[model samples]
Target chain A: MKNALLSIEDTVALIASRAILFVSGPEHLLRSLPRGNWIGGTTSYFMTPEGGASREDRLFCTTFDDAVDARMAILPPNGLSGLIEHRFAHGFTCIVTPAFSTTLQRYAVDGPALPGLYNQPVFGWVAGVHLDRVGQDVPMVFDGATGAASADGLAALWVALPETAEVDLDIVNLFAPGDGESITFPEGGFDVTNCLIGGVPTNLAHYIVARGVDTTLPLVADYAGAMVNVSFQTVDAENGRVRFYAPVVPGTIYRLARTVADYGAAYAEGAREGSAADMLSCNCILNYRYAELEGRPTGGFVGPVTFGEFAYILLNQTLSRLSVRHALAA
Target chain B: MPDGGLLPSVDDQLWARLLTGELDPDIKTLATRLIITRLRIEVAKDSTVLPTAVQELRRFFVENKFAHRDLAAITGF
Candidate 1:
């Protein structure tokens, strides 16, 4: 079975036919389908059979067979991780979370506790806007748990994992931090109006000017061996304040990494080594844009062009994939 | 970092489709292509993504008699 971006008629037939489905595409497009076996999120880009790039209101869906037992859940942001852990604690074959942007985009660290925190392989994308801000482009989620739909909520689809299934979760990242200067924040978090430098909280914009650090380079934080990225939004030298893509978390230690990522190089290496057989991927927006991947191919990747990626952890500038294979019956 | 090797998956034309029958507002798509100024992340493994496994998926939905009832339909309240 393959994951093809369907034509309009085919998409309708697939939805009407009733098949186990997980959908990702432009929010406006997915919203049109009858909510039956399908649950959708929004995105315009995908790595389909046509290589690594396409932007349209097309669906990137995966249909499952009869042997798999599937269940859905609608998790409020309040206790999402716990809900997932509770359901999939015994483990699942596949876990998909096509959630609203509010749940996925608001936090840089992606909240203190997230479902991806679990060791299991999680696959998903952030539902996006493609219509009127009031109705059409509104980000949404369809809770398989309740068989309902809404905005600013989480929809999780869990498939029954085989007793002896060999599940492999993989994330393809292109950059790593180099030995660079250690940058720590103050006891009190620095606001957009200022920054903390050398134990003294000062004007953030001024600090960047004085240091001459490339404001474009994201501030990387090494936490418990995981690399968490903090991207800058605006650095107003006149106002002497700097902003970030997401708010800088409190008490989080950061380091300014001297990173020179080669997307061409990384993509090449991944193409040579990576596999897309029975895999679903959610690629990072950063990777697509930064790597200048438009019209370029990442070999065999096919999934959503997402704002962020989850590989048992919220990851930026990386491609996350989930692979499930049955163990040979012994 | 995931260590598994990534292989190719054939594109399934079944699950996701382009619904032309439905109408959509004339809204502009989100232009977030410029967000990334530089690209970098810790790469330690080969990303292994599997092809779509639709045989069993299609079978599951077919036998289960798949039908979605909205909140109103389910509750009848």
Candidate 2:
């Protein structure tokens, strides 16, 4: 499916024509669309074919033309466990949750522990507002089937592919656990005060300062060869507390990510080898900013530059991608 | 027989390691990850939450013909 950024009129025409879509745009522009078979979230930043872009007037639209059937729903606050149960027989699920909301946190902290989550491919991102209006304006996700928008609700779209089609969900993470002190948290949560630094209990905030850790580089944990990242949101040295964009699971070991001299080039190189056909991809907002990806091509993968990414689980500072391979193509 | 021509003994051993929490989730084979992760989650809630998960996971390995061939050497079993 060819994904592109389109005007409200164009997006509306596609919706009117019954295109099953996952859309990303500003709140005002998204609210203008007529109801149809689609789901959406608020985001003004995107990585379009022309490279990085931040446009409120246009919306990034991904049409799942290969999907045989699509269903959209507003998942209950604790409905993540049933994600696979509601999924199509042989397809994937796209989920959108508002950033910094309890809805996102619930999924982040409890998703991996929930049953039946790993049965299907799940891919999507956290809805976010423009950086200037983050605190002033709340991020919103739209249930295009009903044209209803809500900040606290989780929006899910389950797309059914043909029996002959196989879908793959993966991520391109440039960060690897650096060779430094191993860190472990006492409990799993976004906010942390105490952690074990190389088997020695220490305050995370003080450790970050004393060790000169770069907050931009996330803490990396290896999950079955998949490098998952939990990015730093703030280091409250005054309170001796540290906050992360994603939760650091209790049983996991985390280490500071090795520094990348050039984030854009590194990301581009990392994504260069992947096939771009029938691909749905999204990058993190932190990468867009830190890598200075605005107006620059991030290799072949392109879509919304979201607040957070999901590849079966919540992640930060990474590129999440999903692609469908039809039997004929294989 | 598993698809990759690996021995059933090696697969069973790997399965035992995963079920007993002797293997780290980070190093688990993808084919067994979900089942093992769910098993870990259930076992954490109650030690008795093992039998059902074990049956389900065994079925998964057979249905998928997963031998954990690539990981047999890495896991050193």
Candidate 3:
């Protein structure tokens, strides 16, 4: 089971391989990959604090080309333009290098390329997940308004996936039957537990207790009814620690009843019971939101990973427990 | 009061002085040199002129202490 989860690492490796695969088609010749051009195809950059001369600190970029290619290779039914527009409105900037071909020019942003555009850090976890599921590239754009002064913002890069590729939800149960039996709240009605997920330290639990109108006492809520879905995101910061979290329904009954161990078990169980075709996009804000709920320090940037790497991580980590309704045809 | 208030019509007088090469030659030379240097640096940077250029301009202002209107007119800011 552990080995299976490491398959996400394989997905990361595969995507890295694809990023270096710079074969030019018959129509165009390959040119030198220039400095200052944003290099990560579907990835964005972020910053981290540092000491000494590195005081003007910045985040590092990781390659995830394999999943990006898989998603872009398979065009989504509605196309990627709408997704691109959606991300732009959310304050992401997209840059396309000449290697992707200048003929695909109609979608380019108008006005001269803004100076110091790439100097800021990008938050792109959601888009990276989407590209991993789909196989084709979506247009990326940056928003100039919000966080432009501080150089802290989010960007989404989309790529279309093959119509044939399957996206499904997989769940597995990692806890024993009595592992998460009872959860007690501190004076505040919710207890926050700090734990590590995907190599990141995160606050895993926080919920509001709901009191029924009739009873003066607060009652434990059932979170399952309130939550449509759960998302987990892990980001590596330059500070040698990764930040991560899982978000569920808020202001609902489930907040009082569930434990972090219970949630993990549910996640594993979901993999065991659900189909394999649904795609997941882990929100980058999940960790910060968790920290906010727990009154913990939440400061750090989420670095960019290609779509392929995200998918690889998702699929490998949850595959066996994943309810495999359909299989990729050999 | 004299015609057109107590102040002289300095614009015409300054123009005449410049035409006659009677204005301070050192100030003219410094202004011309600064303008040419700024233009060349602007072209080379291929972006906004660096902070150093702005600092240099401020240093010139401190040394000469020109009137606000004159400085504004000279820089065309």
Question: Which structure among the candidates has the greatest lDDT?
Answer: 2
DockQ of all models, two decimals each: 0.02, 0.29, 0.00
Better of 2 and 3 by TM-score: 2
Candidate 1 displacement at residue B33 in angstroms: 30
Interface RMSD to the true structure, each candidate:
16.0, 4.3, 29.5
Which ranges of candidate 1 are over 4 A from the true structure? A16-18, A49-54, A64-67, A89-102, A105-117, A130-136, A144-147, A187-202, A209-216, A223-226, A236-241, A246-252, A257-261, A268-274, B1-77
Q: Write the per-residue lDDT of candidate 1 for residues A1-330, one digit (tens) a residue.
A: 246677655777886776667777765566567656656666667766555565564677777553246666666656465435655433333333433345554322443334223334455656554322424456566643344666765666665565665455555556556565455554222246644554666776787888897755667764433455666656789877776654465545576655546655654454444366346666766666666666776656777777556554455566766655666788
Docking class of 2: acceptable
- lDDT score for candidate 2 against the true structure: 0.80
Q: How many backbone clashes are present in model 3?
A: 58
Worst 10 contiguous positions by lDDT, candidate 1 chain A? A107-116
Off by over 4 Å in 2: A260-274, B1-11, B18-77
User: Which candidate comes out best when scored by TM-score?
Assistant: 2
What is candidate 3's lDDT per residue for A219-297, written digit by digit as tens?
2322111111122233223332211121221222121122234432343344334321222222122222221212221
TM-score of each: 0.66, 0.88, 0.24
Global fold similarity of model 1 (TM-score): 0.66
Q: What is the lDDT of residue A80 in candidate 1?
A: 65
- Higher TM-score: candidate 1 or 2? 2
Chain B alone, TM-score, model 1:
0.23
Best by DockQ: 2
